[model samples]
Every structure is written in C-alpha cells, then in structure tokens.
Target: MSRTVSFTQMKDGTREEYELLRDLEKPFLRLTADRVLEELRRQEHVTLEGYKVTRLEHGLQSATRAERDGADIDWVVAALLHDIGDGLAPQNHDRMSAEVIRPFVRWDVAWVVEHHGIFQMLYYAHHYGWDRNARDRFRDHPCFDSCAAFCERWDQASFDPDYDSLPLSHFEPMVREVFGRPAYAPEVIREGHVSPLGA
Candidate 1:
C-alpha cells in the first residue's frame, strides 16, 4: 500500500492543489516521485572535505538507513529533509524547513526535521554529562522525544559542516520519506525514545 501526504489548500472547504506521495497506509498515492527524485538529485552542495556531496547525498544516506529499517517513503523523505532549514538563519532553520516543506511534505516529516536540532541538543546534553532527567528537562518541547528517536535511528552522519553536520538544503525530499515511514510513533517516542544525552 502507498501513503499520501494530506493537506487542505484552503481552509474554507475550498479546492486546492497539493503534492501526492505514498505511505504504508495507502499504496496508490498520486505523486510525482520521479520528479521529486530528479529535483533532489540535482541539488549542489559540498561537504567540509570540499567534496561535492550535494543535498542528494545526505538524503540518500538517511533514506538508506530508514529503508533498511523497514521505513516507508515519508519517513525516508523526512530523513532526507531533516537538514533543509540551514538555508535560513541559524536560529530559524527548523522553522524554515517546516515552513518550506509544509506545502509538499507530510506534517510529521516537517515536524521531525524542524525539530531535529532539539534532538541534537539532547544528544549533546547527554553526551556532555546531562542525565536522562536533566536532558528531558532541557529538551523542553513537544517534539523532543520524536526528534530524538529520529536522530537515533533515521538521521545519518552529516557530512556537511557548513550546515553543522546536517544542512537545511538536505531536507527537501526527506520530509516526504520520513513522514511516510517512521521508526517510532508518538506514543513510543513518549515512552521509550528519551536517551539521556550520553548515558
């Protein structure tokens, strides 16, 4: 079964244009997967090593991990777009990624990527010495747990230093991939995803 990203262009029950994609729930979604793939493949970005990795490289690595883990397209896409907010300012990148991809990707995908940094913050918090309780206190957001699980499993090694290991431009299609197939649900996240920064 294919899954699709759902959205209403107009809130007044008016007709609106939207993109089509697939998910585990439904198998026959109306999406230009090839076009999205082409668009993703054409992106141009380099890694800190001066290697031309492009947004495609990041997406691929993330998606590869997600797919191997039995994830769906949306989850894969989320893995791909997890870093797309770097195109904007430092503090606003996540918001930027969510906003930019909201139109084309699933809400869940957008949320994960937009909140990815918080996961990193948690990672560093634990890594730096914060315990689980302290890290939870530091997370301080609704998306913290979900983002942390996303980071633990789907989020890949970011080769782009310009975007802090993960770059905003790398998140375009990722939003779609991840939202389609995620490793954890909100409940699972709330229950078991919190790993104290480094413990």
Candidate 2:
C-alpha cells in the first residue's frame, strides 16, 4: 500500500502531508494519456444526430485527414480529439474538448479545437434556423482562418462512412507522445508568442 495524507482540511495539512500528496500525484498524472485514450475509445459507441459514423470514427477520420495533409503532431492529435466531449457535453463539446487538449497542444491547435464548433456551423446551422455564418463573428481574430480551415478541411467532411480513415490504434502512439510532452512547454509558448497557458 502507498502512504496517504490524513488531513481532513487543506488548511490543516502539514508540510509533510502535502509533500506526500504531491508524491502520490505522480502516478495519476502519468496516467493522463491512458485516461484520454480510454475516453476516446468510449466514444466509439456514441452516435448522434443520425450521423453515418460513430463519434470515434468521425474523430479518426478527421485525424487521418490532418495527418495526410501533413499537419504536425499537435494538429493531428487536436483533430483526433476535437469532438471527444460530444458524448458528454453535446451543447458545448467544442469548449470541453478544447480544454482537455489545451494544456498539451500548441496555441493554434487549441484555438482551432475551441472554435471548430462555431466554424462547423458554416455547414448546416442555417438548416436549423441558426445563422450558418455564425463563425463570421470571429473573422477578425488571428486564429479565425485556421479554425475555419480545420472545420472545412477535416471536421465537416469526416462523417463519410466510406472514407478510408485510419484506425484509433494508428493514432494511439501519437496521442501518447503528444500528451507526454510537458503542458505549456516553454518552446510552444515562445513559438506561438503566447502566455504560458495560452490565455
């Protein structure tokens, strides 16, 4: 068995107890990649809105397209996970998925994931009485074109059941590698000219 802190309240925790808790966090933190992959697998069974493919298939298709288009690992992983939250938070899945990958990916990749939902509206929002051009609100934002390109090139077109999508297993290694990097690494922040947390 492992050691554990006994403090009932955070304010009452001693330095030794806090140290032990911090040590205990290491293994759990290391498992973050595994947990994320498991969640993606869980999405394999999630179907929505009469789409021709399951959420997992759609994610794989998107990632496949990104990889084939020569997108970097971060962008490919972002494509793979851009809709991971759909099964749990359909109303705001984009935000939820964005938050999951935000800490580990580049600023532009996270920005695309965060706004892809609105960009996707360019396809069919008008069919539901919503403005299909709702994405226009962000037209002046620096990442706007990138997000639009993501939706147009990979996301919206991923629903094809016959598309030759790569298997989830094919992306597992990339997912692990991407997640293994330090969250908000100095290089990513400096290259993107963004804050540590990409805020």
Candidate 3:
C-alpha cells in the first residue's frame, strides 16, 4: 500500500506529511484534464428538459464556432467550457463554469464566461417579465462588451442540432494543453489584461 498522511487535522500536519502530500498530488494535478473531459462526457446524457440539443453538443458547437472564427486557444477553451457547470449548478452555471477554466484561461475570458448568463438575458428575459437589459449594470466593466459578444456569437446561438460542431476529440488536445499549464500561473491568468476576443 502507498503511504498516507497521519494528521487528524490539516493544521497538525508535519512538514514531512505535507511534503508527501505535495509529492503525491502531482499526478492528480496533471490528471485534471482527464477529469474535466470525464465531466464533459457525462453531459452527453444530462440534457436540459427542453433544449433540442444535449449540453455536450451545445458546448461542442460553441467551441467549433470559436475555433472557426480564429480565436486563440484561451478563447476556444473558454467557449467550450463556458456552460460546463450546467449539470450541477443550473441556476449559477456561468460562475461555476468560469471557475473551472479560470485557473488556465485569461482573466477576460474567465470574466466573459462568468457573466454570459446575465448577458444572455437579452434574448428571453423580457418574455418572463424580467429586465432584458439587466446586464447593462456591468456596461462599464472592461469585459462587458466581450461578454455580450460571447453570448451573441457563441453561447446563445449554439443550440441547433443541425449545426456541424466538431467532435469532442478535435478539442481534446486543446483542453489538455490548457489544463496542463501550471495552475494559477501569472503568465497564464494575465489577471488584468483584456485581450480582444476577435482573431
């Protein structure tokens, strides 16, 4: 059997125990892409009750759109994962999905993914007696326009079963490349930079 930490509480862990854990965590950290892929694959059957396409198809379509539009890796990966949290957090899936890609993608990409849900309200919120322009509250934020464009160009328009979305295999390498980066790397996050979503 492999060695295990002996601490009953995290604070009581000795340096050696913590070191051992850090060593053991390397493989788990490297396997994050696999776990993300697994979660995405699970969405194949986790359809929203009324959508014509499954969640996986919607994501594949969005990513395909981004790729065909000549978006960079960060944008493409963010597009693919922007709705990944739908299965577990339908009401706040935007934020959940953002968190999934935040560590690997740029700040602007993460911001757009996080807020696309609000921006998307422009499409159907008014029919529900809600303010369609609710997203206007963030109009002055740096990523506001990008978020709006993301909803308009990718997220909201991706539900068609007839769309020729690329298969998950096409994006698997991009997913692995992004997730394979060192978590929270400053160069990867670019915390305050707002790169354009366009090609």
Q: Highest TM-score among the candidates is held by which one? A: 3
Worst 10 residues of 1 by lDDT: 14-23
- Name the TM-score of candidate 2: 0.91
Which regions of candidate 2 are displaced past 4 Å?
190-199
lDDT of 2 by residue, 1-199 (tens): 2387777889998888888888889889888899999998898887756889988999999999988988878888999999988878989999999999888887877888999988998888989999999889999887887887788888899999999999999999999998888878867534454222111
- lDDT string, candidate 1, 113-189, tens digits: 77676556644566667553443543666556666667777564544334333333445455445334433445323
lDDT for model 3? 0.91
Task: Please tell me which model should have the higher TM-score, number 1 or number 3.
Answer: 3
In candidate 3, what are the lDDT values of residues 72-170, reduced to their tens digit? Answer: 999999999999988889999999999999888998999999999999999999999999999999989999988988888888999999999999999
Q: Which regions of candidate 1 are displaced past 4 Å?
A: 1-43, 48-55, 125-143, 156-199
| Error in Å for residue 15 of model 2 | 2.7
Error of 2 at 25 (Å): 0.9
Q: Give the worst 10-residue stretch by lDDT in candidate 3.
A: 1-10
Q: lDDT of each structure?
A: 0.52, 0.85, 0.91
